[model samples]
Target: MLTGALSSRMSSSVSSSDRIFPPSSFGSFESPGIRASSCFSGPNADMNEYDETDLFSISWNQDYGCFAAGTSHGFHIYNCEPFKEIFRRELKNGGFKFVEMLFRCNILALVGAAANSSYPPNKVLIWDDHQSRSIAEFTFRSEVHGVKLRRDGIVIVLKHKIYVYNFMDLKLLHQIETLANPRGLCCLSHHSNTFVLACPGLHKGQVRVEHFGLNVTKLINAHDSQIACFMLTMDGLLLATASVKGTLIRIFNTMDGSRLQEVRRGVNRAEINSIALSPNVQWLAASSDKGTVHIFSLKVRVSGLDSITHPNSPQGPALFHQNSSTSIDPLVSPNTGANPNSLLSFMRGILRKYFSSEWSFAQLHLPGNTQFIVAFGSLNSVMIVGMDGSFYKCSFDPVHGGEMVQQEYVRFLR
Candidate 1:
């Protein structure tokens, strides 16, 4: 197994029968009394067999290669492509609220659920599966809302504060205080050379950006209402944010905190569950409470030299792109491929802005009652994981930009 190195390479889809978990690989030194549930059926087929409330949390690793599912019994790590459960650790009295993996290594950062007396919700346990015990721990006065893991450092998110610590020595590196962030909303860039942290500011609808590489801090007033959900690209060059209203999502340039693009989700209010960006930065995916996944095309491209050009320059596409050696200027052309403007769109600037807001190029529909998180899979494809243990792998039409085709589905938990 390539567990030592962090791999972000994407893979093609496989057959459904090929994804079944191998019982032979279920037994491990770290897990005791681990057993698989009975076969799963339709969506509403079997509710009494298992407790739905046992599922506490689910999160993707830094590279989106694998994801950790935390339940009241224990936690399970599953590979993303074949959708197989790699391994699990089910303690006798163990349950977890958060199980964060540091890449694909044996090390994990765990925060306990309230039901498990073996692990406490207020403490962060650094567990090394190879050693079969926790190597270190950090206990806070209150429950931990979230935990983020990287090779070099560990971040702990509390209700009103975030703490950064060194992974090697567990020494305190820095501390940040923010508004009442019950959701523990924060994002960290995975790029090794650039370390950027995005978290809520001390005020409403504001985000604080920490450039650890340059020792700088920037504050961006992103939205009118409080920020509901946001995401940072793997390279940390771009950020996407949505407010409490959930009608629009704004993309910003992290380096300059400039608004690059604004796309509309809908007029009705909904809770934004998750947001994702393609590895090539060509597409952005977002999920909400309405049970629809929106795919917005960020079709910005420069034909020739890097010079300032009007949005209607007729040469470049309508978004932003960043290179390691060259910096792309921030440009906004919200109506890249959306429908033509309405009759009243040209009357006022504000009216034009609303009518010209970009719409999703493609969409996918699932159960409206379930919450989901999405990530880009292989080229032109997406992966959706729902709170109800549903895993869907779907592909989109890059050219047509309409409904996405479902390629695979599995009830991974049952």
Candidate 2:
């Protein structure tokens, strides 16, 4: 049972599973329940005007129907339907490069975009939208790149490490070191008791996955190049991973490092921007530097898919690999293969170089080789945001695959 050292105090009798989360940093700790309501909160009175010069990041809250765009003037919240700007707030001493909202509510985590700013670059301010003020904050020793808030805990991502804190008062719970991750790549499972964390391993092409509550950690040699992107199902039972090569994507069982399914986007190597899983686990979506988004069906039961994914197939869920233990050993081989330098490995690598990967069941190519972030909405709809500041609401059918149809589009900037 490998475990991360808790920077905070550890109880003498706390079990391994429960020891990861410690008591509150404050005197009292209460689990904060989610209250979903939509509002664009800001202190500014001008909704029609914004300083576009400092604009760098835009994030759409799929569940809230509102998105936040960061700028030198602080951040603005916009309603997607009418495409109206609802809230505006400006930072007095510095600017934000990343602003993360908690659902549709006013609660937000603000991170400084620069090395020298009004606030420390490594600090996070958890704000309350209704009150139009910050209620709490968590400071780190290094610049903070990403922040994820869950009902039970908050996960903060620095360039080289991840910090898990109890959600209510922001007490330090656990800390895990990762490789060079400047983009802050990590995810959390809100639908289950499980907390999933993915970070670079000791070697390239390897990823470490920790199932927090289950006390299970697995090292998956998931790709050839450095891992580019990854996502977990709502229930945390499956994982989808992509490498920097942007060629092959894989679906794995989280309980054990079992490679379940693999999909290819193209043969030519490209930079994959993001990969997402649908709400139902029936669809997998990906977007890359090629300015295209592809959604593939994950329904293993379909006739032509594969025997294991077939409806009546006798194979049970993939067996947890023999190397399912907690260590992140680079040389530990998984149960899927025996020889790392076998003839089959050589041929597979050759085939990959020539044939590329398989095409998605459905795909959409944008106007240019635009970089974008992908998020799912209700009823088979996906929201795409391009680096050039173009946004599109596209819809597709999962049962009978077809080209994604654009429902609505807005260009925030030209």
Candidate 3:
């Protein structure tokens, strides 16, 4: 009834394309759809982005939320969150050539070979974070194999003999004769003022545990080959020992000195160079001559010990007992086995589970084919030192199903 111009203007203007695909229809198509590939992808897609270089050693400073690294040139300090370098210092003392750094209670201890000398005199330098200069320096006759800071800040040097000193005063406290040349020393924090020494002798390795002046336990012929490294948990509940022949890593009960589990890696013989224990006492890590690091979880099993005290229980403390009159094997003698409530049975269960699983190794390229030292610090960080003037800092993520699957895939490919 209306005129053509008036009716056309009154109707809504619309294009042919709009009529074919209306706004309502386009809205339905705009809804996002899930892709199968995106749904199934793993979380490690970005892991390969970071270049893994020849890391010399890595240590974490819990107080500062940072970690320190010692390399061939000098030391690098990095923030832990994003792993960014905050500071780097070039060593005027010929770099960290064949050296190792130990961080204890905000004190940085540097142990390494001196410059220009083929047989570098083992040197220990301690630096406090608050102060710019080194606070203490101790020289050793032999190359320092290992260094440990005790609870009271006493620095223990494991050379041919064990030397204890008040780090603050640089005063010598005790010197104990060792059964073998000590390769490793660890302070047992939980066991009433005790420490354990790992000595790898020409014949066999030995583990000696002492509390103050009293020797609590000693294991002779502990390892078939030379004992290369050892570690004790913070609580002194578990002890891990590795031999020169890296095939076997034995975990023991610190209380009664009984084997809990024996973890082995590789079918052929490999030399275990260093070892470290996790902060939670949940994991034990070992590095071998083959340039591989192996980690294992602790699965403890506890059963009551047999409630019978052996005849040897009455033999006035096993450490001081005179064996001249007794024709008994000290290890098998009743006196040595008299801890009815020692909880050795429960420890053995934990070891059994640890050894049952086949371990997977993570290969690392070190600076040289040098013997490397390893230590577990705050957080999930590990520091390693190669003989050839290189230090590496390695960080680990907790194992998950995806990681296990990936590890298996890599193993199968090899």
Which model, 1 or 3, shows the larger lDDT? 1
The local distance difference test score of each candidate is: 0.74, 0.64, 0.46
| lDDT of each residue in 343-404, candidate 1, tens digit only | 54567475645666778899998974999999999969999999988889999999898999
lDDT of 2 by residue, 1-414 (tens): 111110111112112331122322222654243222122233334423334445668765534377787765566777766466677665444457778876777578777667325545666666665654445555555678787766667778888788888766656778888878877888766653457666666667888888787678888888878888888665466778998899888887666687766677887888889887766556788999988899976632211223334658764344233222222211111333322223444477556443323358778888976679887767888878776767888899766667899998887752
Candidate 3 whole-model C-alpha lDDT, 0 to 1: 0.46
**TM-score: which is higher, 1 or 3?**
1
- Return the top candidate by TM-score: 1
| Stretches > 4 Å off in candidate 1 | 1-53, 299-353
Q: Residue-wise lDDT of candidate 3 within 349-413, one digit each (tens)? A: 66653344335433344433656655554555555545443445665665531121111000000
Model 2 poorest ten-residue lDDT run: 1-10
Ranking by TM-score: 1, 2, 3
TM-score against truth, every candidate: 0.79, 0.74, 0.56
Q: Stretches of candidate 3 above 4 Å error? A: 1-68, 71-73, 78-82, 97-106, 116-120, 156-158, 179-203, 213-217, 302-414
Candidate 1 residue pairs in backbone clash: none
Where's the lowest-lDDT run of ten residues in candidate 1? 5-14
